[model samples]
Target chain A: MPVNSTHYLFLSLLLFSIGIMGALMRRNAIIILMCIELMLNATNLLLVAFSKIYADADAQLFVFFIMVVAAAEVAVGLAIIVMMYRKVHSVDINILNRLKH
Target chain B: MAIYDILFWVLSAIAVGCALGVILSRNPVNSVMFLIITFFAISGHYVLMNAQFLAIVNVIVYAGAIMVLFLFVIMLMNLNADVEPQKGQLVQLAGVISGGVFFLVILAAIKSAKPELMDKTSTNIGLISDLGKVLFTKYVLPFEISSVLFLSAMIGAVVIGKKEETKPLTHNGEEE
Candidate 1:
């Protein structure tokens, strides 16, 4: 039997949930960023699956755009993280307390 | 089960397992490695979905470039479990619970909502030629706009990462 779209959707859901847990539970900034990447990957999986199910290429094109944005986001995000480490000497999110009055 | 179904099951299992590993690993470097594994597995799924272009791009962009960037930052910062402080157990528990609930809600919604299944006529839409045609014709505006977004991000990263110059101070009547 061929793989159904529901199977792909469920897989994406599980991956996304794992990402959410990681982002929430991990205090390290790098791990959190990695988790966010996981979530984005999950969405890309879902988009590809839907593109197949609909027999259309629109969703796949959207996936291409998502990848572009993700690359840009990673570049800027890692730079910000590096800056944060330089100032605070730590990568833990908890250490970023200077914003509080 | 058919060959494709079997492939789907195995790849999804690996993807989910690596995803769990990403969150559970104490070392940031290990987590980045797990994330790479997860990306590879997802690319496998893309192949099964007949998205050849996406599968290749996923491997090159995610597993290749992005994960390397993550690993480099982890090394630059010298991050490890010992250096990073952990959150309280209560917060961890709360995160787990919330994530579980969110998963359950989405799963339930998916089960209840029935999506129309299209006939398996052809898989040509996923080919590079078809995707390129669609991307350039209908989605040309967003495609061009994304290039601009990337340009801005590059400039922003440079500005943010540049070293700040320290001003020199002069003492009274002479430089100290």
Candidate 2:
């Protein structure tokens, strides 16, 4: 069967839902961050698909910008995670309950 | 056309399966590896969709740069399967159910969208030169701003990752 927008949509949806499940269910902060990256990619694929459907280069540029931002975000986010690890010596989110104190 | 369709199916299966592997793997390093494979599979889909620049950028930026950063951080933390935390079955099930509910809701909403069959013929929009032209023209402002953003992110990461000598953040007064 020829692939249509629906197929892309379903596949992106499934990837996104899996991302959400992984993000919510996983306690590892690093894994959670990875799931967030997965979600970002799910949307990026959909954007590329729609970009193709309309024959616009704008959506592709959006994907480009997203990569830019994601790169910066990863730099900062991983640093934060490393700092958190240095302090607590563990990457578990459960121990982050110090916010309640 | 039929070949593109077949490539799509094969790439989609690889993408989905590897994405599952990303979450299901107990080791952070393995998850990073799976995520890289998932990215490569997505890049393959980009090729099928004729998004050549994006396909290359997705691979170079994501699979190459981002995943490496992830791997570096994983290594810096020295995290292994032994350090991985397992959430309770009830919590995992609840998360899955909630996420599934979200998926079904979106699926139901989009079921009304007319599926448009895309043209897979070669296109100029995805070419490097044409994209560069547009990038340096209309989108140049955002492009410059992203550079600034990157600078700030660099500085911020250094600031945050620096050793703290002021406010203490530990238990039992130990600084190790």
DockQ of each: 0.73, 0.85
Name model 2 segments beyond 4 Å from true.
B165-176
- Give one digit per residue, the lDDT tens place, for model 1 in A23-88: 999999888988899999999999888888888899999899999999999999999999988877
Q: Give the alpha carbon lDDT tens digit for every residue of B1-176 in model 2.
A: 68888888888899899999998888889999999999999999888778899999999999999899898888887885556769999999999999999999999999999999886666788788988999999999999999999999999999999997788757888754
Candidate 2 structure quality by residue, lDDT tens digits, A1-101 = 67889999999999999999999899999899999999999999999998888889999999999989988999899999999988789889999998698
Worst 10 residues of 1 chain A by lDDT: A1-10
DockQ of 1: 0.73
Residue pairs in collision within model 1: none
Model 1 TM-score on a 0 to 1 scale: 0.93
Summarize candidate 1's per-residue lDDT along B1-176 as a digit string, tens digits.
36777887899889999899999988888888888988999888887778899999999999999999998898887775456788999999999999999999999989865554533566888889999999889999998999899999999999999877863565654432
For candidate 2, give fnat to 2 decimals.
0.80
Clashes of 2: 0
The number of the candidate with the highest lDDT is 2
